[model samples]
Target: MIDLEEIRIVLVAPSHPGNIGAAARAMKTMGLSRLYLVSPESYPHAEATARASGADDVLARALVCQDLDEALRGVTLVLGTSARARSLEWPTIPPRQAAERINAESGGEAAIVFGRERSGLTNSELERCHYRVHIPANPEYSSLNLAAAVQLLCYELALAAEAGPVDDPTPAISEEDPREAYAEQIEVERFYVHLEAALAEIEFLDRENPRQLMRRLKRLFNRTRLLRTEVNLLRGILTAAQRQAKLARGG
Candidate 1:
């Protein structure tokens, strides 16, 4: 059973309040809830409410966050929306495939992260996601408004939900409760900060000339979608390394 409640549609740094409201409306129409706003340029503005048309409840309940990291908290699976090609190719899938993949998750929070209107998601931001979805559009003029992209993806998700179980015959791999619990996005961010500090302490990461080192690390870790226990274990290892360094320096 696909629990639509567990799906979260995230907007990253949206510039228009109206788009936010309209996106909420789209989600509501498709039987989806849980909208997360990551550092929108404008929100709670009258324009947004007005644009939402009749979905005021969705607008009122929207969860606003300071950044994408905060918006993705508790989300075990993250799919980013992007149109342009990147130097580093991620697991790219079409909208339908993205919806089906997310629908197949046994239980856990899944997020479809959309970017800003003008620039979309930056390369660094996209790296934080496990997969990226592309919406087919006219190649000559493929630029899509933030709200339109949300609507299209939500439509696909809605269709996938109503179409019954996916027909794929591949057996789902079993693990020790993959959905038991996952570390919040904030916890992951904290680990990255701690990891960077440790790397600097050991002279492995040069702050002055750190070029894409942290971004690469983020991709490496995000791919695994670390569980809460896994995060704690990694942090413990980080603390141990820090302590060892302190002892070596007689501090």
Candidate 2:
């Protein structure tokens, strides 16, 4: 069973309170809850409550976060909504496929991140996501309102839930598999920090001239969807490298 509560609707830096409220309404109408507001420009305002139109419960219960990292603390799977393609070419999928993928997760928190109304997700923000859900609207003018985008994706999620899990030939992840306990966003982030430090220690990444080195590595791992055990193993290797580098330097 797909627990709607486990699927969080994350709004990143939403500038309008009305959109937040309307987004909540859209979620409630579709049997979705668990809204996470990341650095909302305006919230707990009268307009938001007014726009909720009886879904104020969703607004009241919304978790306010300082940033995407905070909002995604326990989330294992993350999908960011994007209106167009990017140069990096993330694992792009339509809303239906995104919904199916979210539904297929056996456990742990999953997030569908909605960016600001004007600029959408920035490069750094998009890099945090494992996949990008691209809504194919009329290309001539594909501009979509924040609330409208939330409504569309939420609708697909509800539909996917009602229809039950799709029949797929692939074997489901077992409890014994590390995939069952995929590394959480916070843990993965810690590994990145460790990686950067290890690289600098070994003089692999020039601290002053570091450009796309980290970004490219992030893309590689994000696409890989590393498991918890894999992350631990990688970090252990980085630790060994750092130790060896220090020994060579007579530290």
Candidate 3:
């Protein structure tokens, strides 16, 4: 049986400690034990422990990090839960699909990250994830409590885990086998930074008035699930482009 413990449920900057507790309960119900919190506004509050109910152990053992990158340490695959669409089209999948993908990659560490309750994941945060998941809900009022969303995803993952071996003949690039590794979130962020700098040097990106151009590019590249070699290749391209731009300017 593929172990589900390799998956981590990450909550970033959760404002309400109650939501954290409820989310812990959700994880316990679905047989997931790992939880990571990044820069939570409040924790160790009464509301949180009360909401966790019998799942207090999860809260007790929850790994708290100073930032998202720290929380994502050693995780190869990252999925962001986002309700809204960005300017560029990201590889959006439903909860079930994400569950199946995660289940398939059972040996390696993966993270499904959720952002703050009010704003969801920001553009910068979403850029770090390899994929985005959007739950289909009432379009008129699609707001879901952070805990409810966590419960829904955990439930789907539990179902996927129990379904036994997946006979997926055509898994997407993002759903590659666990043995094939992808760049970590921190490495991907470095690539984004380098790419942005290279673009700015070439005058392709306006330093002063850069709009959503970099965000869109990030979405495009993230969809590729670039491996370490691919990231190096792309960075090499950026370096070459910068050299040409400098030569063109006689600098």
Candidate 4:
């Protein structure tokens, strides 16, 4: 059985204590147990207890922390919820995708963070998260309540759990076969060399006045975090360009 103990729902600076209680109830309905609160306005109140609706147990066992970092402590993965897309870049994935990732990574402690009801998570708070999860809603009006968002995420997670872990059908390659490398495993030096060579061949990087060409190119490629196939393709293109250049120079 996929243990719900590994998953935690974190509320940051929740304005309404009743919403917190309701969120606890929603989480319990989906079999999620852990609840972490980061500086809630007023917890353990009569209103919160009343709103819990027989789910006060969830609230009772919830962890209360002073700040976001304190609540996030010992959590290997953190996901932040957002309704509107922000100008700043963050790793954004749909709810389904996020659920799959969470299930796969449930071996470690993980938490899904929801912000205040009024304003939602700020850009800085979103930046603290490893990934951003956005629930799909009607494009015309997509405002989701705190409890609703928690319900949707918990539902997706439960569905994912029922569906079972996703399998990679592709057989592992033998030593003789070309092993595919993940983006993290690819050598940065090789990419730099390939890029520099390609740029030189194209006369894009002038030696006389190379103001910021290389730096810009480096930033661009680094952003991509190129996978094995992408790196190989780039190197191939650079090799072809070099060959063409050599032929032109009468090599």
Candidate 5:
């Protein structure tokens, strides 16, 4: 069974206090408790508390973070909620698919990230997630309320958790397997940093005018659900490439 308790709901740069409270109430009704707030514009407000209604406990324990990285911390799986596609296409799935992925992870914490109500998640922020979750609505009038979105997704998660064990389509990696688990968000970010440096060293990625090259590369790696050891192997290659480039440059 998927551990509902291990799943955390993250709100990034929320603009309204009432939305936070309403979202907390929504989560509580659906059996989710952990809440992480990233640089909320206004929190600990009376409006938020009043909006939470009977779910003040969830609000009371919400972790307020300085940035998205701080909010993601140890989360092994991350799905960012985005309403529209960006300059670079991402692997987008519906709520049910997201629940399945979250349930698939047997040993790591999972996070569902909701971006700002108006702009949604920035391209860079969305890059941190393994998949982009989209809710299909009327194309003409598809604007959804922040709390309403949270409520719908939480409902899906509740159903998935209570429906008993499910058959995962992907082959389950045994505990003894080296690729048994995914790398944490922090580790993945470090690998991206290393990759960019290596690319720049090889004069492949222009430092000043980077354009969308790195973002596209990130999409390729992030969606692959890179394992810790896999990240190390790739970074080791990058290190060797950097060394070779330096030697060739006579530096």
Candidate 6:
């Protein structure tokens, strides 16, 4: 059985009171009752109560903390939301992947950190997190509202916890298969290399102005975390295309 009490939703310096209330409602809807408000702009506001709807109990029981450190006192695992990639190297995972990790570590207390509505989490705040989570979205418009992000993440965690750990009933097929899985970033990098090579061969990449294009491409593929099979499929297509091009040129 899953323990909802092990999870805590932490809001850091929330600027809008209504978002706070709405987030609380979202948490409650997902069977997550614990809420920690870290230096919110305003508490006990009418907007918050109105937005909270019937989740007043969540707000009432919320722990108000002066800072994020205080709010994360006993948390064994911390997940922070970021819309953009940071310079610092941190294990970045999608909401669903993070949820799986959280479910596996169910015995320990965990916290999901949501930043202010406008600017989102700062570099300093993100540094405090052990894991960084970003919701998959269209690169053209990836900005997600604070409450919406919270709702999506909370929903994923709830679903993952309820489903329990992934059950692999099949016995080991080969001795080559490692006991652990590769990190998401390593998988992404392999896919990106294949994708970039394909694009270059097709003469699609602009050699003169490839800066923005690569960044946009990264955003596009990073959202999906292409599976090993998917990556192989894409590479195969590239190989076929290259062969066809060479044959045509020779003829």
Q: How many residue pairs of model 5 clash at the backbone?
A: 0
Task: Name the 10 consecutive residues with the lowest summed lDDT in model 3.
Answer: 168-177
lDDT string, candidate 3, 31-135, tens digits: 888999999898888999999999999999999999888988877678999998677767899999888877766334789999899899887788788789999
Clashing pairs in 2: none
* 198: Cα error in model 2, Å: 1.6
| Candidate 4 per-residue C-alpha lDDT over 1-251 given as tens digits, one digit per residue, 9 for 90 to 100 | 23666688999999888899889899989889899999899987888888889989999999999987777766645688988676555677888887887776523366799988878897656645667898888999888889889989998888888788774222232334333532222244456667777778777678686535655554455444344566778878888988888787789
Error of 4 at 79 (Å): 0.8
Model 2 regions lying over 4 Å from their true place: 167-172, 176-180, 209-211
lDDT score, candidate 5, position 231: 88
Compose the digit string of candidate 6's lDDT tens values, residues 1-251: 23677688999999889998999899999989999999999997899899999999999999999988788775645788888776544568899988887776523367899888778787656655657898899999988878888899989988997887764222222224432222233344555576667676667887677645655565554344344455667668878876776676683
Clashing residue pair totals per candidate (backbone < 3 A): 0, 0, 0, 0, 0, 0
Report the C-alpha lDDT of model 2 over 66-93, residue by residue, as the tens digit: 9999999999889999885676677788
**Of 2 and 6, which scores higher on TM-score?**
2
Worst 10 residues of 4 by lDDT: 168-177
Estimate the TM-score for candidate 5: 0.95
TM-score preference between candidates 3 and 5, better one? 5
Instruction: Report the alpha-carbon TM-score of model 1 versus the true structure.
Output: 0.85
TM-scores of the candidates in the order shown = 0.85, 0.92, 0.88, 0.66, 0.95, 0.65
What is the lDDT for 167 in model 6?
A: 40
What candidate 3 gets wrong by more than 4 Å, as runs, is 167-180, 247-251
| Model 6, position 106: C-alpha lDDT score | 24
Question: Which sequence of candidate numbers ranks them by TM-score, best first?
Answer: 5, 2, 3, 1, 4, 6
lDDT string for model 1 (1-251, tens) is: 35776689999988989999999899989888789998888888999999989988888889999888788877767899999887667778899998897777655578999988888899867876778899999999999888889899999989988876674322343446654465666677788889999877777899998647887778778777677677889889988898888888888
lDDT score for candidate 5 against the true structure: 0.89
**Pick by lDDT: 1 or 5, better one:** 5
